[model samples]
Target: MRELSFHGVTVRFGAGRSALAAVDGVDLTVPAGSVVGLVGESGSGKSTLAKAAVGLVPTTDGEIRLDGAPLRARRDRRRLQMVFQDPYASLDPRMTIGASIAEAVPGRPGRTGRAAEVARLLELVDLDPSRAGSLPSGLSGGQRQRVALARALAAEPDVVLADEITSALDVSVQGSVLNLVRDLRRQLGLTMLFISHNLAVVRYVSDVIAVMYLGRIVEAGPAAEVLTSPRHPYTRTLLDAAPRFGVALDDPVPADSELLDDEPPSPHDPPPGCRFHRRCPIGPLTVPERTVCVEKDPQPAAADRPHRAACHFASDAAPASLEVPAR
Candidate 1:
């Protein structure tokens, strides 16, 4: 059912001495019309993967495939769109929001249909097309973010990679934008890779969730299952970090009670075994899953059938700790 796939994808940067691996070999499948959430703390390589998917960063290794065809082979730039975290920064200051959105469209056809598309986008994100002429500086944070979404839509891409699209806005304003994306997903039958560090945000919009730690997906499953019953220590740490009204998920208070704090190891000097073992709380792993699980990486293991976690004790590992009351 997944339409997008990643095969052993890896991305490194800098020269020989300064080279750093940002996203290590990561394999994933994203279903069409499904919102797959990618969550991790800052520098966890979540953004890097998103950038790599859109070819923003040259891959150090691995391959990306869309619709069963190789994505790395072709330069079908318009087929996939990217919406970055900082809406204000991603947009152009000189261009009207309309022109910004229209730019993604190409040729005379794009020029003509641009008006109707803009109107539809405004309604989709709850913005007035009349504001198309407004500058990014004039718009509120939320409005500017919505404009970013509208611009990405202009391409009519089959898949949209949204990296922390809401982190830059007020909490209240975030809900509306998320709902709009969900609504657009239904209307367009799109395949979205919605990346966010906030588990709560990912839970709200994603159909499936992939928990990323140090550039690897340690746990993945239905949003509810992973959120309610995670099997990976890192996943537990993430869920515990979320602030639910009644639940006590409270992640171990950070140094300053920062919640989650394990500076990702330098990819160039990643730990010999298990890049996450340094921060992971669970002790289960498969020989191959952890083949290098200790000094190697693990593969996603089936837990509750379709649900998966990459741990040797996938079958028996206790669910990650959370503050939510057991219902």
Candidate 2:
């Protein structure tokens, strides 16, 4: 496995004056043989950052490195692989699962040898080797997803970029897929960047987690620490919005909370200072010391604890400030 690092990476689209920064100044690292979860709502630029890591999207500034070496213009295709969100969309409709997996395998193999390799790949993902003859449409969502995963692993990649791979699955199936990924990481010692909007899913599979908002990472640290004692208000809000299994859908939400309510500011023209200030429940409009949230942009700074947060008031607020209100 290899360490993956992003140093001040930025991705922008369109021309000068009309340019929109999709991913802005992201600095993150995934240690060798570990999973780092990146979580955010839609349009938070997490997916764009993932694309930049895999060279699908161009970075306008800074660099991405594997094992401290700067990624080159041309890279080994087998060293990194990306598993996209939609399994159905990612698979080839015309080909059998075996054929697709064999196509992605690294190196030349004769017809008979490649088929054996494909069976092994399928087994690695907990799929039956006999399914190799099945078309993508013939398999269930979970089975098709595992096939997609198997195809990615055929390259024997050092790093896997999994972008919301389980978001579309049923609850029971989601657990199985999550478990498959965890088991694969342990068995293969794989390094991974798992991106998702589902905080609960990320919390289950990640060793460390990064919370993104408006094209920037607002907080990052050990998964337990970041989730339970989140320093950033945005991080807290996300946790609050994640539905509790036993809680009724019609249960009254906290009236004064800043969660699951406001939409994020438009990325096309992000606000000055803190991009979250407009929707921040504890900003200048609500709290006395939070005036700085509207006056200046806060950089990711070390908090009182192990993690880092971009909010100026992070140090002042207690983690329990975000506790879900009793229904």
Candidate 3:
């Protein structure tokens, strides 16, 4: 089932700083009943892609289609739900958890039979119905996030776009929430676009992976292949950062937060040639990879199969940076 597809999607704030021109030409397809993980740093455009997928943000260029229908084509909105990182903010401080969920359901008047529906939704997310009466302020971080999940499901959606959904939950509860989502996806066969900066988290839940940089996908492939033998330079760096991701970046000596290049360029006004030329670590690689990489742009089909990368040298480039330990 073609749940979602983006053809040559590009997002530019305007024409000046080159932020997303790096991703000028991108094609994304989310097959039905599969989890596609979109991974990148804070400004890598991962979240922007997520927001666009669910119609939370508009795309500056290109087209986004859901179930082969244009996403902008008056979607029911509830059909494709989003689970935000801040669970508390997604919920209302004044409204009860039960009412919050009921609002997502169509044509539901008042709280009639809402108690049972709330209970069922809570159970769906491994929460207790008794807690439905409680406000988001009364719930723990994990519980609040769980409530967020339940609320997303309240819409009875066939597809879910989870943007850093578990970032705020306790490590202990992270597994359970991920498990719940996995279980639901398996049982309900829901299609999901799981956006996250955590490589491990993305690896744990995704069937396939799409690594983003600037505003384009640098590498994409089966999760196992991409994680085990990453190809792109950005992919390796991100993996290297993963081992120490838990460390407060501010406290880290050099700080992983350092811009790979400079200013990340402006999404509005990008540079000439490869948008990543300024930051691409591999000095100058092979023909297609390097020639266009820094001065031009790269197509995402450099790899042999599922492991497609945008770098010109990505095909022959060895994994020099991130090497997982032998377990």
RMSD of each: 4.8, 2.7, 5.2
Clash totals, every prediction: 19, 0, 16
Q: Least lDDT summed over 10 consecutive residues: which range in candidate 2?
A: 251-260
Per-model TM values vs. the true structure: 0.85, 0.92, 0.83
Best-matching candidate per TM-score: 2
User: Can you rank all candidates by lDDT, best first?
Assistant: 2, 1, 3
Task: Name the regions of candidate 3 deviating beyond 4 angstroms.
Answer: 15-23, 109-112, 244-271, 285-292, 300-306, 318-327
lDDT of 2 by residue, 111-147 (tens): 9999999999999999999999999999999999999
lDDT of 1: 0.74
**lDDT score at residue 213, model 3, on the 0-100 scale:** 70
Top candidate (lDDT): 2
Residue 14 in model 3: lDDT: 43
Question: What do the candidate models score in CA lDDT, each in turn?
Answer: 0.74, 0.85, 0.74
